[model samples]
Each structure stands twice: as C-alpha cells, then as structure tokens.
Target chain A: MTTLQAPDTPFLALDVDRVDANIARLRQHLDLLGTPLRLHVKTAKSVDVAARAFGGGTGPITVSTLAEAEYFADAGWTDILYAVGLDPHKLPRAQALVERGVDLTMLLDSITQADALVQHCRTHGVTIPALIEIDCDGHRGGIRPDSADLIPIGRRLADAGCLRGVLDHAGESYFATTADDQRAAAGVERVTVLDAADRLRQADFACPVVSVGSTPTAHATAELTGVTEVRAGNFVFFDLVMAGIGVCRVADLALSVVVTVIGHHGNEGIFTDGGWMATSRDRGTAQQAVDQGYGLVADIDGVLIPDLLMVGASQEHGVLSIRPGSSRRLPHLPIGTRLRILPNHACATAAQHSRYLVHHGGSTDVVSQWPRHNGW
Target chain B: MTTLQAPDTPFLALDVDRVDANIARLRQHLDLLGTPLRLHVKTAKSVDVAARAFGGGTGPITVSTLAEAEYFADAGWTDILYAVGLDPHKLPRAQALVERGVDLTMLLDSITQADALVQHCRTHGVTIPALIEIDCDGHRGGIRPDSADLIPIGRRLADAGCLRGVLDHAGESYFATTADDQRAAAGVERVTVLDAADRLRQADFACPVVSVGSTPTAHATAELTGVTEVRAGNFVFFDLVMAGIGVCRVADLALSVVVTVIGHHGNEGIFTDGGWMATSRDRGTAQQAVDQGYGLVADIDGVLIPDLLMVGASQEHGVLSIRPGSSRRLPHLPIGTRLRILPNHACATAAQHSRYLVHHGGSTDVVSQWPRHNGW
Candidate 1:
C-alpha cells in the first residue's frame, strides 16, 4: 500500500470510500424519483471517477468543455452533452465528434447562436443536437421560461433539426442559507424548466428531455415529476460549500489538499505551503453562517482541527490561524507536520491539480492515482 | 498566419512586444542602480519568456515551486532559487536538483527549520545553500530583521555551511493606494533586508546576496543602494492590479484571455466563455481605489473597452457588464465576436493555462506557442 507520507506535500488527496458513499447517496435519491442521472464530468474531470459514475456501462454524461467531451468520448462514453452555451467557432470540433458516431449535444440560449449554428449545419449538411438553456434562478446564462423569445429560439433550432431538450441549473441554490431555502429554490428550478419544455411542446416543437440540477437542488428537490434527467457534478466530493448549504455534512467531504507546515508566526499563526495555487481562491463559504475563511483545517486523519481556519492565503502560502471569537490556542505543529485542508468548493479546488492521490476507506495509504484533464 | 480566430475560444494571448517593453523598462531601472535582476519565473512559467528575460543567456531565476525549478534547470537555467520557505519533505527533490549540477537555493524563516536542515546535512554529508527570510512588511512570511531571533538563525545556517543570503518581499506594497505609499514600502523593504544582512555579517556569517522586490516596489523604489539583487516577476506582464497601483498604465499589460461572445443578457450584460477557470479568482484590485471587477474588458487589438468589466464569473462563464455609474450602453457584440480581457493579477491568471498564444507587437498572427509547467 502506498502511504500519504510517500508523496511530496501540497497534492490533492481523495478518500475513495467517501466518494463512493457520496455518489451512492445521490444516485439512490435520483433513482427513486425515476429520473436518470446524466452525471456532469466537470467536477472530477477524471476518467477513473467517470468510469465509476458510469456503473460499468456506456455513459450519458455532461461536460462543461469540448475538451472533456473529447476525453470521455474517447474513453467510450459517447453520449455526452456540452453544457456551456455554444460558441459558433466550436462547431467544427462538435461536427468532428458527431462524425465519429458520438451523440454530442450542444447548448444555446439565444436566437443569434441558434441561427449561426443552423447556418453552419446547412453549410455542412450535418445536424447537431442542441438544448435551450432556461434561466431558472437568474444566476447565469439562460433564457427566462416565460420570455417571448424562448419559443422562437426553440422553433429555429427545431427547423434545423437540432433541437433536443430544455436544461436549467439552479445555481442560486448555492446562495441559500438554509435547507428550506434550498428546497424552495429547487422547486423553482423544476417548475421553470418544465414550463419551458411545456411551452416548446405546445409550440409544436419536440421537447424530449427536461434537465434541472445544481448540487444543492439535486439533493433538496422533493420531486422530479416532469424532469427526465438530473445533472449534478460536485456530489462526488462534497465540500465546505455543500456543508454550508446544509446538503452535506463536513464529514462527507472527500477531497482535500495534503500540505506541510513550513513555519510558525508569533504562536497565533501557522504557515503552510498550500496556498491559492493548491487550494484555489474560491471563498464559497464566505456568505455562509459560519464562514470557513479559505477552508477548514484538518489533521492528516481528516479530523477538523477545532477552531483552526485558513484565515488567509498568498500565491504559495496559506496562513492557518484561530477563527475569530474562538478562545482555542493555536496547535504547536512543528515544521514538516502534514495536515489535510478541506476546500471551499471541490470543483474549484480540484481543478488546480493534475491528479489525485487516492486513499481507501479513510486510511492514509495511497491506493492509486487518478489523472484529471484541464484547459479548453 | 494563425490568427485569433483560428484557435478555440478562451485561450491566453500574449503581446510579445509589450512583454519585451515591460521587461526592458524594469531591467533598465535596476541596471542604473547596479542591482542584478533575478527574474521570478513564477509569473510566466514558460521557457520562451524566461529566455527573453535572461537576455538569451543562462538565467539566475527565482521559482515559487520545485516543479518550476526542475523545468528551467532542464532548460539550462542553472542558477535557481526556490523562494517559498523550505519544507523538509521537499529537501530530497532539492538535493536531486543540486546533484544534477543546479545551483538551487532554499528559503527558511525559523531556527527549527535551520536545525532540521543541519541534521539532514549531517546525515547525508551534503551541503545545501539557504537564505534567511526577513519580514520587511507583516504581509506574509519571514522574521523581523531587528529581532534577536534573526542573528541566531543566520549563524546556525552559516555553521552548517548553508547560509547564503537574506531575502524579503514587501507584499504589502500591493495594498498601497498611491505612488508615495508604494515608494515608502519599497524604502522599508530595502533597509530591512540590508539590516538583516549587516547583522549577519557582524556576527561573522557570510551573507552574500540581499534580495527584495514586489512588482509595485520594483517600479516605485528610488534606490537599491545596499541590495545585491532585485527579484520581480509580474513586471514581465503588467496587469490591472499594477495599473491600480499607478505603477504601469493599462496599455502596458501584455496578457489577456481571448474569448467569444456566446450570449446576451437583458441588453446590459454580455456572456463570454472565459470565467474564473480562464481568468482566475485573483481580485487583487478589489481593495484599490478603482476596483476592476474580475478583469477589464478589451478588444482583440488590445484596446480597452470603455466602462466594461467582467462583473461576475462562474466556473466556465463570465458575465461582462457595464461598470456601476457608467452611462455607456452595452456594445452590440454579436455571437462569435472575439474580445480580450486584461486580468487583475498576471501571476494568478497565467497559471490557469497550459500554453500561451504569442503575438508579436499587437498583431493577430500567432508567432509561437509557449508551453507552461503546472502542478507540483
């Protein structure tokens, strides 16, 4: 067995058992709703994790970038959906994937993109499947379900034989401070996307798939009556942000960065080699009730060091100190002491590393390595 | 010629001429003070940029990670300094670099680290050179120069034949709101590192190099009288943060992310493919007098898009909107229209990509592809 002590400091560590549990819980919840899971591969960006998500079969996975679509497609997961709004320049790449017998679906929320994609398909004599992004919570890209522009956009895509479904992400669910608030936001997400699909079908457009999710909404939504698929990525490694949203407990976080204590400052602060580069600058928990500064500091065994928070971070250094209003004295960790830090957002933090050091069943032993893809 | 329209959307573009001019201006300023510029390679982790910084000769460069040191060492940059404080677990990697005939110097700020190094050297019979970090500003690491602890730490390292120099970084200079404040911080940095070096020499320890710099101080400092070396990394690519500090004009920024307009939001917001994944989450300019949101919007020709800022970012989407109080209407950028965005911090933004699309002067033609090293 490979131990954590063997690798160099400041590398991402993944607990396989926690990951398995997190995935199982989400799968079970979605399965009970009769909605198939179209797992987003953006969070882990690793084939090993995606393989497990596929459950030993060819997958219907979603991707944020075409690079990820290419990676997972090459790995035999041919049914892929590129979730971000489509840019016309990427059509050639999308065409190449389609030519390879991969069922790659693109996303768009505007008539301008629809017309351009339609013209491209006409010029090339090849059809591309696309989804109309619906604005569920006003957090990001998407058209309002009731907007007068929504039906025309879908009609235009349907004329080009490219319209596939409707998708919405309740990203604002992450901002909800309580479980009730998250559930309410999830409720809003479901009705909004379903309304858009209903509007399209009423307009004589074929709307087959209705997709809605965000990690918070994925776990909080009470029903998936009209939704055919649920897409959530971050549950494979629940993070401090998920805990803040009341969706998962801190103990469920599977991802952390193993760092070494490099120095001490005046008995009030400890410095580690893990900084924004290793941990990322996503302060997702800042607006939560109990703000975990950068992340919650944990011992090597994954136990939270009480009251210790990464108060600040530079490029390559993290300042570990006692949280405000806490009377706990700083731990006297000597130089070279190894510790694991739970991140604010698993997706953001995991994107910083190229690979993960896997440990099985809460053990420090490194069971295997998993590589992740980055860049466009 | 490979133009901006040739590559996929959301890739890093580098203005080679601006990079050259920025480096030349800083080099000329330091050369007048008779201080050698040990360029920090952490900003643009590319051999192409480092070769230009080294003026076509072997480099005396500084790195924030050992991975960078190994990269440049393999590329023929022998004189290297790993600026982050030493962690014992990384010593073996450092030793491997030294054994391969690389002059790699480590950094430490505590006596505990000194004693550990002494024991490691005694056990292996190998001598490793190290620098004592001095705290010029209470921004991050290093012991205060005037503290009694400084002399003992230096003496212990000298006894182990590992004491090489003293180094400090006035990271607080970034918080300075005016040129006078930046100059004052730079002055303090110069004197503090010099004081530590003098104390070491008085205690019969050989303190050869005295290094200090931050991008703001590098351009604002009036003199480097007693300092042997000045290390500045971000000057190679000035950013919005430097512009906020009044060090460099916005025209001097050489790096930007080229992205395509994918959608429009309510006639006031435009969405692009570049997000925190492409631009990074370094909001260094947030505390400055003028807070450029995520980044300042620019055209493909590197011209500023007036009153436009990237107001918010998700994992793979950036919301470009008019800045608050700006009466300018949003530009009518159709889908597929390409634009560039100037980042807040060059170091943080540059670390997000695998390679740079280099363009000579402001030309859209691609001149070269420079690969960068990432991860530990």
Candidate 2:
C-alpha cells in the first residue's frame, strides 16, 4: 500500500540495482582476505538489505544497539556482536538474547564491567559471551591493550565462563586521509588485537577471535593474521564521507535522500523540505578537508552539482546555498523540483528514517518498502 | 515484555507525569487566550501521547507530515494541517487524505505553487484548503505578509474555490533575547495576519481564520486580535533551547535521555553510552551565552551536575568533561553509573527512539512504555 506516492520532498529512496552492486563489491573485496566478513548492521537499519548482506555469506554481524540485535535476531540473524561497550544495567537484555538462543557477544573494556557481567550471569542463570575491547587508536571506547591486569580480567571472565575473544574496531580509520593512512591504521589495529590475544593466550585463555575492522581498513589491509574474522559496515551504501576518504567513489555511493523544492529565496538560496529533521544532523565529514555541510546536494540522476550543499539547516527546513566562491546560482528550480542529497554519514543518516523506498530500473517509482528499527 | 528493566547505558526515558502537566499547561494557556490551540503533533509522534494531548479539548491539530496526519486521522483526529510548505508532486497523497474526509490544510508561499496546486487539484478532482504562509520575521518559510501580491494570490485561490485563511508562525520568537522580543515578534505576527486578512477582505474574500502561533509568543502574548486559532506545538515539553531563550525553565523541560557511564577516559573525564545518537545532534542553546554541548548532564533524580556538561559526543559515546576553565577535574563517574541528561531539543532527540521508557511516581524503575514515530 505504501507506494512511490512520495511528496516532492525528503523521503529515503533506495536504488535496488545500486545496492546490489555495492553488496557484491564488498563481498568480493572481503572474500579475497580468506576471512569472513561480519557486516555491521548499524549502517543500514533495513532487515531486507541486512538480509541481502547476510546472504553474501557473512551471517555473523556487529550491532550498535540491543534493539538492532533483538530485531535481527528475531529475523533469524543468530550471531550478533554488540560492538558497544557493555552496560551493567543491560545484563538482563543480554541474558534475554542468550536465552533466545542468539549467539550474542557483548563488548567490555574494564574490570568493573567484567565483574558486573560475571555477577549478572551468576544471578540470572545465563552465560553471555563477551569480547574485551582494546584501544587501537584511542578514537572512542576501549581499554589500552597493555593495561596492567586487563588480560587477567579476560581470564577472570573465562573462569566465570563468559569470555569470548578480544576485539578492536580501528575507528580512527574513519579519519584516514589516504589509503596508506588506512593501511597503517589497519596494521596498528591488527597488532593491538593480536597483542591482546597473545596476552590472553599467555594467561591460558583460548582467544579464538582477534577482531579488527572498518570499511577503509578492510579495503586497505592485505592480511588479518591472528584474526578469525573481519567486521565492517557502510560498504553497502557508501556516503560522501567515504567518497571523500577515497574508500569509495561517489558513483558507488548508493544511498540518497529524495527531497522536494518547496520554494526559493531568489538568488539568496533555495528552500527544501529536507532539513536536519529529515537528512539528520550528522555532519560526519565536517572535520575533513571538504566539509559537506549536511550532505552533497545532487539531482535525481545521481549527478553531483558540486555547487550545492545544504548550507543552513533548521528542524524541518534546509537552506541550500550555492557553494561559496562558485559563480553558479541554482537554475530556478520550481516549487515541485525533486532533488536527491547524498549524506555525510550513512549510519547516522539512515537511522533517521523509518523505511527504505526501494527504486528499481532507474525509475523514481518505489517498487518495494523495507522497514527500519529505531530503539534498543 | 519491552520492560526497559535497567535499560542499556544510554537511551531516552519519558516522564508521563511531566507530560501530563505539560499538556495541562498548554490547555490552560490557550484557554486563557480564549482561543483553541491546534496541538502540533510534530513534538510527540506517539499516537497514544497525541490522544492524551487531544484529551483536554479540541481534536484539531497540526502535523509535519502527511504520514503523521494519516496516522492520527486514522486514530480519529481528523482536522489536520500538513504545516510544511506544499509540493505539487505530493498531490495524490493530499487527494487521498481529502477523499477520506480528513480536513487537511495545505500551505503555499508563492503563486507558482498556487498555480501548480490548482492544476493538480483540477487534474485529480481533489479539493484542498489552501493556507497562505505569511512571513513574520524571515526565520524560515512564508511569503512576506506585506508583499504587494498577497491579495492577488489570495484572490486567485478564492477564485479557484480552495482558499483558506492566512496562517503565520512567529518562528523568530523562539530565539528571542527577552520577553519583550517575543512579545514584539508575536505582535508583528498578529499584525501581519490581520493586515493580510484586511487585504483579502478588501478584495471581497472571506478569510475565515487568521491563525498565529509559536510557543514563546503564544505563551506571552495575551491578545489574539484578528487571530481565530493558535497553532503552537513545543509548549507541551519545552527543552533547554526554550529554557535558554527565557521561554521555559529547565524544570519545565519534560523530556530527558537516561544514560549510563560506560567507563572513564581518564582521571578527569567520564564516558557515557549516550551520544549524539541518543541526545541528538541539536545544540539548541549552545549558540546562546551557555553552550549545552549535547545537553546539561543530570543525575537519575534530575539533578544537574555543576561539574559537567556533555562536552563532546560521537555516534554511541558521550564524553563528559569538566566544564571549561574550571579549577578542578570532575570526580570520575565510574562505570555502571546511571545518569539522566536534559536534551537541547526535545523533538529531535525524542525522534531517535521507537518507544519511551516512561517512569511513574518519581521512580527510577520504568512503569510503562510509549511508542514513538520513526518516520513519515
């Protein structure tokens, strides 16, 4: 019943063919490493697309939220690694997932959390597998790989019967300025995880997985020695951020926001219904060299105008100004002109929508709809 | 069984008692104005909360999307205004809503849009009431109320037999420095609508309803003058942005994100699981004298910590640093610490979750859950 009947404005549209190509390329790229890819589900919320990613032989996946793990686990995605650091309060939910027969692996970075997990399993009568998060590049969460007593904490968890392996995300790879930077970061991540694994092995713990992944690093690194699997998301529908980082070309960026031109402020700017509310306030690549304000504004044909980015964004209204120093004013697009904007961060942007309007065969008409999840 | 029983580290939690109080205040405020308030359904997407909002008085409401209009209309809140600027491409959805006997008012700013709407309506055999947006201060959408062609466009729509009264949103008042600024902006909005109504009247057109609203202006301005109804939405659950602008107090902010301290970054900083993903990327009051990075981080009891504000936020991690220029580091909040954060913009932050964990009777334990809308 929900068809291509979209307002001339901000709605998420997926090109089925483009998505297929993106999935295939990622599959081919990861296949060469002789390691299985654990696709991260945080990037695309749609189980339909996630299922397509899963169909490519990466049944195991990483999840950012318990809601994602729950939703996908309900949809038959059994192997899930909750990449977010474990919260003691969520022990019940993690135990519930385990009770549901999900191979849910949680991440923890401290002894306090390890003790809490041990206590939760002791109290709840459920054993939840966990991976110790190691700091690869100090981007976000994780304990330093060589921290005193950290490996003993992993041994303590295994003694309590819940430890799984050691993992690292190499999140700093997102900041890599070039492929070489990505490769270097990837090597650092491999070393960090391998070192942590070695320490755990020295403590007589069977560390089966040494996880280190990110789309850029996954493509740049040739070897994953001492790691059992790789995990990377966002390769399915790349964004302007990935394009700017040289991880993928703009042509390979499959996702886009369909918006309508409601009105224009003459030469000053054009107004679209796609504001922070629709396109999301995720200016993921703003810290990079070329700041894509909200996103790179483009026409429906996927042609990047290079002179248009949402300059000023309010809650429900976006002001698309001509890129500074560019002599171009937008050709008087009428009140109904439809435009597509490529987002800066695919994960954050995609999380803002409820579903994907799948478009097939280059038509504006949406042939199918795929629902998305919002909470944990 | 969706018990947020000790929810994950960072997530949004709603206080239903506060929501009720907030709703009561809106009703009392509008009742004092001797005009009915068209509750903006954009603030609370839950149909259940929307039902609660309509419980006090009139059922007529304003919505940001046709999807919302349809959702609430199906729940029997039929008088809906798709408040965003209308696009001709969405004519079919408009037609469908009208055909189902939903009183949907569409907004238009330019005569170009009017022409297209007229053409679309004639082609589709659907009649939509047209509301001309009058710009009060140029914060966002609307034609300048004093524009020379105002009467001509109104008369054109009148001739076409689909014209409604002029509607003006004093959005600029939301950023007012003082009560006087809000009052003046409200007065200007009133004057703009009255002047436009007079122009239409002079043209022998019957302007049934001259509407004006914005929470700041609507709450402060006592006089309605020529206005028939007020459409103010965020008055239900004002946030830090509203508090910073002197419109509402922080205590009046009904929504707060409940988060957990995952780990400590150093001796001085505590890391929480709530990030931009949970609190939203809206730094609503940050541009004011005080910068609420993500929000004013609070304790479970809604007590603000003078030592900290969320200084930096990533997708799933928030760094709580000691306030800048402070003499000392914060007492590091250890892992598993539960914290509640007052949001900068309630609407944006609340939209990130599927369901709100509603706490009852000043209890830290959740008593109920309310579902929220994810998309149109």
Best candidate (score: DockQ) = 1
List the DockQ of the predictions in order.
0.82, 0.58
Candidate 1 lDDT tens digits, A1-376: 7798778889999998898899899988888888888889899998898777667566788899999999887887788999999999999999999999899899999888889889999999999999999998778999999998898899899998999999999988988878898889999999999999999999999999898888889898889999989999999999998898789999999999999999888887999999999998888888788899999998888888999999999889999999999999999888899999999999999999999999975589998899999989
- List the pairs of residues colliding in candidate 2: A8-A260, A9-A259, A9-A260, B9-B260
| Candidate 1 backbone collisions, by pair | A2-A366
> Local error of candidate 1 at A69, Å?
0.2
Q: Please, what are the lDDT tens digits per residue for candidate 1 over residues B39-138? A: 9989999889988876777678999999999999888889999999999888889888988999989999998888888778878888889999999978
Q: Which ranges in model 2 have alpha carbons more than 4 Å from their true place?
A: A1-9, A24-29, A54-58, A122-126, A360-367, B1-11, B20-33, B47-57, B120-126, B365-368
Tell me, what's the RMSD of every candidate?
Answer: 1.3, 2.8
lDDT of 2 by residue, B169-267 (tens): 887887787999988988988998888888888879988978888888888786886788888777677888888988888877768888888977766
**Model 2, span A168-217: residue lDDT tens:** 98888988989999999989989998988988888889888788888898
Where does model 1 sit among the CAPRI classes?
A: high
Each model's fnat? 0.77, 0.64
Each candidate's B-chain TM-score, in sequence, is: 0.98, 0.94
Task: Evaluate model 1 with DockQ and give the value.
Answer: 0.82
